[model samples]
Target: MTVAIVGAGAAGAAIAYALRDADADVTVFEKSRGVCGRAATRRKEGCRYDYGANYVKDDDERVTRLLTEELDTNGLVEVEEPVWTFDSAGEISPGRDSDERKWTYEDGITQLAKRLFAATDATVQRETRVETVAREEGRWSLADAADTVLGSFDTVVLTPPAPQTAELLAAMAWDDDRRVAAHDAVAAVDYASVFTAVLHYPFTLDRSWYALIDTDGEHPVGWLAREELKPGHVPEGESLLVAQMGHDWSGDRIDDDRDQVLREAVGHVAELLDDDRFAAPDWTDRQGWRYALPDGGVTGDAHRSTEDAGLYFAGDWVAGEARVHAALRNGFAVGERIVEARNAKTY
Candidate 1:
């Protein structure tokens, strides 16, 4: 059997890992130069920061075991500090912390995908954008944006964001009601936009919390975290703050000039933290996530209707939660389903 997975994000990586020992050939396609999709990381000025999804939470038992036992724990670190809360008025308070374990590598959160793909024999093609997925005579074929045929496979798993998945389905050369249904259902999934600003300072911040969240979802700055809280992320006597603007704020300014966005973000951070020193940063970086978080999961069984046809979908959107663990767990479930189907010789 052969399988092709699209988007080398957490879900795609997890699926490939789960099928590593299976009697099948698997290939993964990623558009970016790196993997892990929104669980992204970057290094600048000797500071490493997770500018996307932050860290994975110990919300699922299976995922916890997979991280702690299955994968290498060499650089694994747990964030000891708690997360506090803020309001629309920029009033800060404490009390939303939990016993949930927030896990990330000393390098960054992207290590999750790196570690998973490392354990798999699957061929991961980076900087390769799969623009087409067509069904051909009981099999699937994929093509790049240049119309170059990649390969043919017995099964295809799509782990991109729902909007992109919907586009692929709409353009696929398949004549089935299930295709239309899946496209419609996948297209209907709403997503939230986020604009993240990375600010660097020459001084450190003394705070009891690892991060701060907007409890009412009415604040311009939705989340602010100190990168130094994560081990090996930032140097001593220095601070790096990741400020993610709220959905409305992000959607409004996502297309504006980058410099303007960074300046405004700095002002917002200063106001939120009640520190005039934050008004000016030694250095700054920014990333705009147009489809940062899924508002809800896909509706109806359209996604499952085509599974018997050797097509599958996995991601946070499919799992109904915008978390890395949810995407990974869903990928594991989908992989197990495919393995079971193969065992039964159903496909």
Candidate 2:
């Protein structure tokens, strides 16, 4: 049997990883040049930073074991400092202490997917955007935007954001009520927008916490983190701050001029940190995630009803959480279900 997984993000990668020992051929399609989706990483001028997701916390035991025991842990690093909290009024306070482990790669957070894909025999096709999915004669067919046939598979799993997945289902040629139900359920999952600003300074910053999050969600900057806390990310005596603007603020200026957005983010960061140096970063970068975080999950029965038709969905939205661990867990569940179905048919 053959399986085609769309969007090589954390969920997609986890699905492939879970099916590594299964008796099926798995092919993953990714629209971008790189994988890991929102848990992204980039390097610039000898500094590596995770601009999309700061780090993955050990919220799930399965994911924790996968990272520490199952996978190669060579470059794995943990943040020692705690996360502080701030309010809309810019009043900073010490957050509650917790023993949660924050994990990331010394190279960057993207290594999570890269490592997962490396351990599997699955084929990863980068820069391949699967535009259409069609079911014909009990098999599934995928095509590109220009109607170029990619391949036919026995099963297809979609791991894109809820909106993108809904769009794909809407365009698919499968005329089944399950498809419509899945589409509606997936479409109803709302997302929160986030605009990230990477600010770099030539000097170091003295701070006790690794990150500061907006507790009430009313601040312009929802999250601010020091990339230097992650080993091998920033050079000594230098600092890099990852500022993620609040959902409301990001949605409002998502399409604004890039320079203007960066300026406003820098100003907000400076005021929040009470440091004028933060306002004048020596270098900067920015990214706009229109569908950064999902607010809700799809109706389980609606999506599960399509599984019998060799169509499945897995992602953060499907798991009803915006965390990377949740996405990985959901992918594992979906992949295991597919394997079980295949085994049952053989018996």
What TM-score should be assigned to candidate 2?
Answer: 0.99
* lDDT by candidate, in order shown: 0.94, 0.94
lDDT by residue for model 1 over 13-82, one digit each (tens)? Answer: 9999889988879999999999999999999999999999989999999999999999999999988899
- What lDDT does model 2 reach? 0.94
Could you tell me which 10 consecutive residues in candidate 2 have the lowest summed lDDT? 338-347
Error of 1 at 331 (Å): 0.5
Candidate 2, residues 1-347: lDDT per residue as tens digits?
79999999999999999999997899999999999999999999889999998889999999999999999999999998999999989999997448999999999999999999999999999999999999999999999999999999999999999999999999999898889888988999999999999999999999899999999999999999999999999999999999999999999999899889989999999999998888899999999999999997886689999888889999999999999999999999999999988987751
Q: Which residue pairs clash within candidate 2?
A: none
Pick the lDDT winner.
1
